[model samples]
Target: MLRDKAVTGMQLTLIIAALLILSSIGYAMGRRRAVAAGRGGALRLHSRPSYHGAYVALWCALPSLLLLVLWSIAEPRLAEWLLIARLPDSIRALDPDRLGLLVLDVKNLAVGNIVSREIDPALQAAAEGYNRFLTLSTAAMVVVAISIGVVGAARAIRGVSPAFRARNQVEKVARNIMLAASIIAVLTTVGIVLSLLFEALRFFDQVPFFDFLFGTRWSPQTALRADQVGASGEFGAVPLFAGTLLITVIAMCVATPVGLFSAIYMSEYAGPRFRATAKPMLEILAGVPTVVYGFFAALTVAPFVRGVGESIGLSVASESALAAGGVMGIMIIPFISSLSDDVMNAVPQSLRDGAYALGATKSETIRQVIFPAALPGIVGGMLLAVSRAIGETMIVVMAAGLAANLTANPLEAVTTVTVQIVTLLVGDQEFDSAKTLAAFALGLVLFTATLALNVVALYVVRKYREKYD
Candidate 1:
């Protein structure tokens, strides 16, 4: 059993290493054969030696890798079916759920995990059989995979000739791989949208769509017992929407001007040395982790804001939206500054020269020509920053309290859609309940809102770009 366990652990690594070694050998052989074919200028090859090498390597590795993947996926299910088929008649005659639990116990016992039932003779025999099957399957996989790789390499090497279109074949394969990747990305996005839509539909069946959308309360706790408090939970999302908008507005107000002014200074006014030194330092803020930003907001910025508010005779919650929004704005500064600076720098030097030739000062040239020309990209950067602010979870979780108060006051405790989504889905959850499904509803709405924002931003960008052009 120990030997079987050791082999199972190391077999995958060994198989991959062996395949790599074979591919390297095939490449060397193919390149050598190509060079010999073109020796003494007797015949010119249609493709380069390197392309021939790559062709042989691809043939040597791709088939074996595919077989390995398929085998790994099928082996477990096959073994489990065989194990259940060989079980005792009494065990096989049990209910489906109980039989499944018994099989699970057998597997756990086989893997040295604590099993729920006693280790009887039947269970021990099943464990042994299971381990034996896995060992045999792994051994067969290694042999078959390597044998296929050798056959592929031999055939590819034999096919290599002066007239073989190795480059075209290799390029075709590369194009197919890229196309597959693009298809996978599109399918993945479609899958996400469908999953959210289906789950949110289920939630809407339980809670009215209008009530969820327009109600002011945000409590999601459902009572497990009839006499429990808050047996009927509110799913109104207006408070969450209000909080998201308030924080996003505050963040944009702080980020837009500071980030745009910084970009303008770095692009137009600062000397080369100063720009080079300051740009990286400013962009470094983006690399700082969000948890660190959350900590700073909770421990430092929140207290400072509360102190100032009280000094001025204003009420301030310990976890107000102001602190979270301010810190979030600071964290997103680099998104705007870096992108806007790059866009402004990309403006044609001829435009500046033309403006100066017309007797415009530096400031006048920037205001009249440069800013107008870069407005589209500047708006793009701000849109990206706004999206960042809306999606932020950690900062709001730490610095802003999870009280979904539908208020415009920044000094009050509030929570956004993302924060509520996290709150609803935390820990063990039953997916059939409205409490769990509400998270999906919130996610769908958030996705729609962001998509709408993107459409508007694109419209504004196109309009400005047409005017500038």
Candidate 2:
């Protein structure tokens, strides 16, 4: 048995290297050809020499690149098909799963993997043929792709003339590439949403939709057999969402005033030097990793919060939502402050002068004029901060405890939808089990909630935007 994985990788790398060399040559030759066609007069050329060079390079690289991408995608399936065709009737007669395993075993042997199957004469022959096929395929790809690149470069060089719209052609190709990339992005998002929706629907088949939505209990442990003890599962999401709302509210309570006030002061009161120095220092909070915040919350803030609560004769849980929410609030402060500062600064200075012309004070002018104008942006920043708080998992997992207590009290132990999703999918999971499938259900709910927040944010922004604009 022989493995050609390294050979295939080397072949692809060499092909890319060759393509780059050919494209560079095409670039230099195309520029010289265009210059010659224009009789060496810069004014006689239709487009710049650089544009002509780029046009030729694109032609040389694009078609061959497309071919390489298509071949790479199809190569594995083609190899499997060829392997299946060479296998014996008995191997082909096996069930799909067993046949697939046999094919995998053959591939392992062909790739010099430690195969569990006994080394038989048939496998050795198959490995030899597979290696030969791959070797021939690699050689064929190299010859075909290089030949296409060379022919395309030659044609482009021949087509170079003083009247040729090389820039227009290159720009059009770039535009089409951008359009394709945008379409791919949109299709990928749709694919992900549909995947989640279908899996959630599968989960709802075993668990009642109404029960999962409205039931208070959230135990997802289902009995494997009817006679098994302790097999009842509850799919209620009330506690998870409640805890999420509670923590978000606590976070917002801390973030909104402090962030907005800081923004107001920075934009309206602070000197240029102070704003420059303080703004970056403040925003550096946003750059801190959430895991670092998590450990900080778990080790330091959680204990401090507990000690304070006990001193006040209140029984606070060691892992309280207060600690997580406060730390998360600190993390999101920059999001609100930066955006609000920019928005306030964007409010026309003329509006401030108008308010002052009417004998209004600076504070009055800011409150009456600047604030109204920047209300939409400020609200947008707040909503973004809220969304950040909602999606955070590490801080909650560390400091809020995974108890899923449906309480509004910030001092209590609680968990969120994201924590539950991580919990259910942490280890080796059976997709069919209610426990694992519940993660998708929770994910779907979280997506819906986030979508609702975005919709509300859009509505608020639009409604207030017209008023000021």
Candidate 3:
């Protein structure tokens, strides 16, 4: 089959491009109408004319865009059915798995992909016909959309009766759009929670919740054949919890003092010039990719930690929990510093002045007044940072070992829930296996933990916001 000059996605893109061009043309026409009215100085323009332009633009764009979204979603399903319906009875008679493979080959061949078999003319024609149908549909959509846009724009301009209330309509539309956009936050959270919940439910089906929760072993290996030798399928999460806890504690130890002090200095002690220079410099930390931090943890920080431990007459594993957590803490410092700084700065200047009037030093004013005023925001930011550290995967993956040794010792190599999840899902495995399902369980736990942290942080911030506002 000779492929079309334009693919389906590209065709849709061109139609969108045409719609934008038509919208621009409509805008220009509306502007011209406004100029003509102004020149005549007889019939007053009902609206500031740009509103008429935007009205036309919305007409030109919105319906077509909505149709495109709907069409794109439905096209694949309809096309698959169309192809499957045309398959020969012999091919259709194949088992489900084999039928899938046969369909794959037919699709590949229709796309001019090299196949061992000779050319199939029937399939090739079907593909070409499908392409033609799509192109005609696209062209028709664009033309109809533009025609409607032009007609609608002309009518709106002509019927801009006195008290047409163009501005009110425009404001009403914008308000509705803003409200819809705000719902995206809730939608995203809901989608993520639902996905994790479903997967965790699947995991729970394979491994009993009590076994996953209360059992002490952490082994995830299980044989495909039940008769196979030596395949222990233990599913305890205690070590992962312990490892995560130990690292999180070490990370807080490293991050809190450094981040809080830096924030304090920047907010309270630094000169205007110093604050300007330092704030961006500190935020640069947040922008640095976590992957770079992973390598730094594994290569640079791990060795230094081991050297320090050896000097102190202690044994430190090359891939110790401390190495990963310490680096992860450094990676998250900017989150604490930037957020705390904003909250501290938000504290009313009157409070600072009042404290100073009481003959307190700058340090005393900040420590007693500003810090307390900002404490809720500060705690919120800390909780946010802790959630970040807990969900962190890469630094731990590279620096922390895979052994699920349930130990509190930071110097010992330990694995986390995330690391085990990665290990379970790394290679190709049966999705139904306990190994693969275990990742979902781990993910569900992580999601639940982070969600809890966010709830607490929001509550704290909201309470403080109510007090101050």
Which of candidates 1 and 2 is the stronger one according to lDDT? 1
Encode model 2's per-residue lDDT on 1-469: one tens digit a residue.
Answer: 2445676777889999999999999999999888788785668988887788989999899999999999988887898899889987877899999888888888888778888878788878777777778778888899999999999999999899899999899999999999999999999989988888988999999899999888887776678888887688888999999999998998898899889999999999999999999999999999999999999999999999999999999999999999999999999999899999999999988888888899999999889889989999999999999999999999999999999687888999999999999999998878888888889988998899999999999998897783544
lDDT of candidates 1 onward, in order: 0.93, 0.90, 0.80
Q: Which pairs clash (backbone N, Cα, C closer than 3 Å) in model 1?
A: none
How do the residues 1-469 of candidate 3 rate in per-residue lDDT, one tens digit apiece? 2353347667777877877887788777755666565554534656676776666566656666777788678765676677777776776788999777666566666566665555567657555655555566667666765666566666656644433556577678788889989899889989987887887888899889999987778989898787876577999999998898888888888889999999998888789999999999989988888889989999999999999999999999999999999998898888889989998999898888898899999988888888888988888878978988888888898998889998988999999888898999998888877789888889888888887878878877777753544
Estimate, for each residue in 1-469, the C-alpha lDDT of model 1 and write its tens digit. 3544565658888899999999999999999998888776744999988888889988999999999999988998999999998899989999999999999888888878778988899999998899888878998999999999999999999999999999999899899999999999999999999999999999999999999999999999999998999999999999999999999988888888889999999999999999999999989999999999999999999999999999999999999999999999999999999999999998999899999999999999999999999989999999999999999999999999899999999999899999999999999999999999999999999999998999999999998792433
Ten contiguous residues minimizing lDDT sum, candidate 3: 1-10
Best by lDDT: 1
Please give me the total number of clashing residue pairs in predicted model 3: 0
Q: After superposition, how far is residue 56 of candidate 2 from its true place, in Å?
A: 1.3
- Which candidate, 1 or 2, would have the higher TM-score against the true structure? 2
The order of the candidates by lDDT, greatest first, is 1, 2, 3
